[model samples]
Target: MNDDTVTATPAAPAAEPESMPAPEQPAATGPGTPDPADPATPGSRRLLRAGAATAAAALVGVAIGIGIIKTQYDDPAPATAAAPSTAPTPTASATPYGAKSNGSHFGSLRDLLLPVPAGYRPGPDDGVYGNDTELNGEQLSAELDAELQQIPKDKRDKLRSYWEGLHVKATGVRTYLSTGDDLVIGLKLRQFNQQEVQRINEYTAVFTGDTGLFRIGPSIPGHPEAHCYLMPAPPSAPIDYLECSAAEGDLLVIMNAEGVAPLPKDKIVALFTLQLDRLARPGASA
Candidate 1:
């Protein structure tokens, strides 16, 4: 599949008073003299009115700030027990979501037809596909060239190597709407026999080093003949991505799901299975 470096948090602000405390509760000097709370003195009344206005303004600012944060970071609601699903959860495991990936047999990776899930819709415009286009192509596309410039030159080679060795036979780029806009998924089918799959798995087993600006992640749950890795972006990059592949028959199917938000493990698996199911159905194009 197209290689994509995974994506990119901030510190919460301390809840201190946005405004200075009102004049440190002016000392009540001379009991008979004007007290700060005394309505009898116009200056005392003015201070009280000013304090009320400042407090009200601070409350308004806080409410607006919270509204912005929630809009930017809002996430899907947790799945509820009563909700029904054709997709069932599997026995718990050590994988990123404890998912038991589809172990069912399949004829070929080339036959699987990908489907856009419910919450996911197609991207607005045609988005160029690849892990990150610049890293995989002989010439970086205009957009990717810009994203790459964000990374330092010394780190470029390492990023290129992540997809440099992979042998891909075909690639399909599809845009989907999955709780967000322009979520791009790249599906790659590679030619790899049983022996080759074993060798590749062994190679990835000990392969640990700099991935340029990309962050390598742990293997996901179940698969037929390969492992899944959570590919994240360097702290500097703008988005996130995931890569999972396994040998199916004579072909290795690699999936690259990416967006500004990190996709859940189960959802990626769901998309994978959806493609496989499409391929399995009679007369359906993979």
Candidate 2:
């Protein structure tokens, strides 16, 4: 039984030898082989990884540098010098009656630029009232109207109509009786007229009687010639005279203030005459 078994087993084919893994060979080193510790080495995985990391770090560094450069060069700071002050300039003060108040008569017309009349005591009214007359302002105006009534009917009618149109309300009428020292002075303010205004400006006087005749040339710098005359007064007062005339535009003005005591009649007449003469001189046209 042993012989048969041995023959049949043909000697279990010689046992196949188990193959062992070839011993690991050292990696081949070419001309550019890298060392694992060196980042610049080629063909070394550790070196390639380190190099990639270093390149990435360098790119990041460049970006940070560019940002810093831009920040430093782009925007500038604002100027810090102190700002200038802003203040208003001062102006000059204006003078009184100089281009401010147009010519206004605060007192008697004559008082504005001439010597005050002698014995001319101030009246209760701001305007001068004659001290020589018993008649107050109202009575003087009435007497003036009575005197005007003596004009020719047609002329009186025309004059009355004109005065009515003017809305004239007589303010005062008084006579200054001549007291040898002064001529009688009378003044009446009824209404304003352009012609009478012009005449007044020219200093022209109009008289209604024989002794009143006189010529007054322009006394002002520029004005037209003016004429004066004496008109009859009420018989009761022979020395009293009515000086009536047309002003600027048929404006009737009558002067009847009489001069007495310290004022001469001739002097009063001459004073008025001189005043009118001044007016007759040319004045600068309005």
Candidate 3:
């Protein structure tokens, strides 16, 4: 029932090799002195002189050749304009899923949540008055701080460090009741730093993987990143529940549905997909 169970699971780093000192550069040899390690003979010195003379002659010949080539271009031809390019100028690539260039939604996070369907009405208010609820960055941080008050100081410090790294921005919540089935549906969106969205998604998957009473809910068509989970009622319990979680851009989408046994999995998935589509293209969905 709480997305807070999803935490950062950082990968362990590989060990690096021990540092080694670089070998010293060889000392430069001067023209007058042959390297003492390998003294030059008289015949070798004479051969070196002849080689130097040949190199000087080659340099002179190259200079003369350059003058001849330079003279050929001395009388330049009239310049002509360049032909216009036929290819179209490139435009910036479209943003992924039609989100903003920076990968976050452009406006109110609540607006990004899926609208209530035809047969549903606003569900019971679990918060102040309305079915919708919101919390800003400071409010969220304060809430976490209140929850962490009972823990040891050292553990609190570490948890606070991880919370700071998330850069949590805001959260939005909405609920709905199906008139015919008395099913209660809840939706929540938590916005945070873009870099941590996928990490949160992975953590959610791991947290929900193969636990008792929890099974894979359903697949959200066209969205491989989104997942749904279902927890059926136990013999003593009468209500069944379905939950969906996805990382959409910088926002984490969470959905919950509760009703009698045999909860409508297709309905839950369809609702989830609609929500994702709205996020993918805000303007069109609006």
- In the order shown, the candidates' Cα RMSDs to the true structure are 22.3, 61.6, 34.3
Ranking by lDDT: 3, 1, 2
Model 2 TM-score is 0.30
Measured by lDDT, the strongest candidate is: 3
Total backbone clashes of candidate 1, pairs 3 or more residues apart or in separate chains: 15
Name every residue pair that clashes in candidate 3: none
Give all TM-scores, in the order shown: 0.38, 0.30, 0.62
Clashes of each: 15, 49, 0
The candidate, 1 or 3, that scores higher on lDDT is 3
Clashes of 3: 0
Local distance difference test, each candidate: 0.34, 0.26, 0.50
**Residue-wise C-alpha lDDT for candidate 3, range 125-207, written one tens digit per residue:** 42331356667778767766765564456645655665677777887767666766436676777788666666656555654
TM-score, cand. 1 vs. native? 0.38
Q: What is the lDDT, from 0 to 100, of the residue 177 in candidate 1?
A: 44
Candidate scoring better on TM-score of 1 and 2: 1
Please give, for residues 1-286, the per-residue lDDT of candidate 1 as tens digits. 3321121110111233322112111112223233324323111111111111211111111111112112122322321112111222222443321102332223232233244458764432212331111121323323333444544454333323322333322333343445544244545443323344444433332321222222454444344434445442334323345555554443445565555434466776777766544433233333
Question: What is the C-alpha lDDT profile of model 2 across 170-285, one tens digit per residue?
Answer: 23223222323234344433233344344332332221122132212212222233233322222232222223232323222333222212224455445455333322213424
Q: Which parts of model 3 are misplaced by more than 4 Å?
A: 1-98, 127-130, 210-213, 235-237, 281-286
